[model samples]
Target chain A: MNVKVIVRGKAKGAVLCAQKPVNFLGGIDKKTGLVRDEKHDLFGKFIGNKILVFPNGVGSSVGAYTIYSLKYNQSAPLAIVCLKADITTASGCAISDIPLVVAEKKDYESLKNGQEILVDAIEGKIL
Target chain B: MELTKEEESALDGKHGETLALAYRILVAIGEATNADKLIPVEWAHLSGVNYNTIGDAGEEFLSHLSKDAKFRIKTTVNPMGFDSDNVSKFHLDEEFVTKQQSIRNSYVKMGATPSFSCIPYEIFELPKNGTQVSFAESNAAIYANSISALKTNKESAFSALASALTGKSPHSDLRDEENRKPNLTIRMKTEPADEITYGLLGYFAGKEAGSSVAISGTKGLDRRSCKSLCAGMGTSGSCGMFTLGEEEGEKIDFDYKEMARVKDELNTSESGDIITLGSPQLGLEEISDLVAKLKGRSFRKQCMIFCPRAIQGQIRNLGYDKELTRAGGEILYDCCTCLTPLVDKENIDAVVTNSVKGAYYLKTSNGVDVNLKSLHQIVEEETK
Candidate 1:
């Protein structure tokens, strides 16, 4: 079963899961696409061209630009899977044309790093 | 979601690529949030202006957008990466200036006001109560909703940019009065008279509210105090906007016990080398007050006052800039310590500020030591 579609797009990529809330702004390096926050679980991990998964977003309204920056630099994730979708991540996904899915609690728990996933946003499926 | 004819046309690409992209973003966000339709917005206050925060990729994104887009509504930008005049003074390298200035040029090319500040409400002419607009900055959005009575979603910078291009936003949540009615109420034990109390109230209330609408029972909060409270609340979580004073809701009694805990959390044992103010952008009066306090004294370490360029000019005209600089104060413009890498670059071990939001970000996001103090206390400690 897939999560609810927040932004309608289709993508398939390896997973990069973050258990805690992700602060995109100042949290990730735009050029390198690496998570910069030393405190984050996925610190030093590159998010480019993956299916990024996090619980939700936190910090800085400017974080939306970080998402856009990721896309502009060709480092944005292919899709996003979150436990709950907040306005910050939603706006980022919408503007950047990134497929965003808010998963069920069980589905969110089951998601793991490096899991090859296919996101069908129109049909609302994850395979 | 229902879209008006013009909006639909814009979404359909009849109005060109810029409007179409903006429309698409609005529609997508609206659908996700279960918005009924689009509503016209009078203004947009944009964030994502700093280069140190947004970096090279963000500069490219803004450039591309501005190449094809012109704002449909009046829009104001947030602070830039560095104070232009103080780039060398702040010890910013040459490349940093180029990248940061590119961001400013893009937004200015797209017709956004060069008024760089997080507190855009003061720079722009705000609409009457119930006026619909899009604001992305957390503190500014809270201030607009709670104090100015202007309706806005605590929008992200991307959405605010879309609203600027389309002059419309998804009609959801804060746009409607019925939805804004408080679901959680924090009843304070004492009147929140000081800035610290207001900040604590906001911090405590944010946790209590937690994705639910909240209102504070504390009354007679001055504008700065209200702002401080909201800034604290914003740091706790994405609680959106909270109401101050009594309103109908589920009441949560808060007393001195809660205040004590919050106070403890906000402070640190470490001494700070730098005194930075205005994460939410200091007001004109606050700047003046700081100037008056630091009239003759010279600080041992750097004292940085972060504000917009316009206000910096205003202070310079009033001769406060000279007094502040003479007393070892640097009235920096465009960026604050919270949003930029200046603190880390300068190797600032610690920071002391009156801003609860500022302190929270410094600790959590920036990974810097922070000690919270009232403006009066900070002034006393720094000046002497």
Candidate 2:
């Protein structure tokens, strides 16, 4: 299997395999499921379930609502896949009720958003 | 798939009525999220200031049926809105009082606090980064929890309330170690512009991305609450136009009832520009000052005022909203009017205002004319 890594870093915790994809529309609003902070690459994408692949979190607290709104609007990706975890994404999962997983640093380095990845949060494993 | 011992007991009438009521509410929330099974809660935050004119009827039932306010979690934080302090502070007036009271009284009988607004960050010292807890629907609270990644179950408002009562929810949807990882990561550096409200700027970026999402994000937000852009904001329109005052700052509180008295007298005829200061939910003296400002001038291409719908209505009812709206410049709701596509596309040149949040969001998102100003200074600048 071809292994590709985005940002090199150490991750702690479980890794889950993803079948779908979530786009990274940058910071998501919690109250409204809209993408926020035009500075982000995927600015203006109502992110739901395309396999959001990101290193960490950014932007305002209100973005949490946007993430939730994305879930409600059917815009959120199947699950949140991260190289490193951040509060923004965590908040999105918490409010959106979407599944979120993290990988070990070695796995996080080898992981890719589009690439098929497996993670076990309870056991803290990533593949 | 069944409730935990604590939850079952609450449902079975083991806990007191208060908790039972919250549990019932949580059940609905879980259903809405399509949670496979509820999970045992770590804690909970009771959100709901004054009751909306309408809300989850189930919560009302739980509140009534369970008077003892049962509790499954060892600790919880529930905040109410629109009490005397909120009424005085935010300017929720008589009509607001009556409407909210009727709704709250129903739940209050079950031990709900009659407060208003959902800025949970204000009252609750929630943990950050995966803090597990169940949270209900509230724009403000949602904002706080999501920003910090405080653990919360995105169940329906009703389900959270149910959980409050029963104390146990199905643990079906809590992300396994595998599913909770973030997939897409985006990073960018904005030319930190002057006069931009730091927080709102982040929001603007989210808004832009939201627009791009396959799903329409705004439509969903509307379902939650009627936004009051004008309610808690201030604006300015001298020479050009701008909103004045920050959502966070030294509060410029008002008495809405007093302002309503002079509601009939306010007009936005001031010529060169206009400046708004703080929330338009004002008292009588403030209205008198506005009417006086409009006494000798006519609105320009820069006719603008940032106000909540309530105050805007008062202005419109007094023959201002129509005049303003007809001029292709009217009040906005929920979110700021200027932030809307209307003004951003139109004549918003070299913006100046008192609100750091607005300044930050606009400057960062659109790269527009932005400046920071004090409420009084904005008025002075616009007229100059």
Winner by DockQ: 1
Q: What's the lDDT for candidate 1?
A: 0.79
**Considering only N, C-alpha and C atoms within 3 Å, which residue pairs clash in candidate 1?**
none
> What is candidate 2's CA lDDT for residue B210?
14
DockQ of every candidate: 0.56, 0.04
How do the residues B1-384 of candidate 1 rate in per-residue lDDT, one tens digit apiece? Answer: 888887788889997888887877787778667789888899999988877667777777788878878887889988876787767766677788888888899999999989888887766567887899898888788888877879898888888999998788998887877778787778788654678888888888776674445554666677678778777777666777876566665788778988888877767645787888777778788878777776677776777888877676688788887887888877788787665667772487788787777776676556788877777777777676
Per-residue lDDT tens digits for candidate 2, residues B114-197, read 222233333345565665565543233234333445545333343444555445554433323232332221132222221222
lDDT of each: 0.79, 0.37
Off by over 4 Å in 2: A1-36, A44-48, A59-62, A83-88, A94-97, A119-124, B1-352, B361-370
Tens digit of per-residue lDDT, candidate 1, span A19-44: 77887874787667899877679998
TM-scores, all models, native as reference: 0.90, 0.40
What does DockQ come to for candidate 2? 0.04
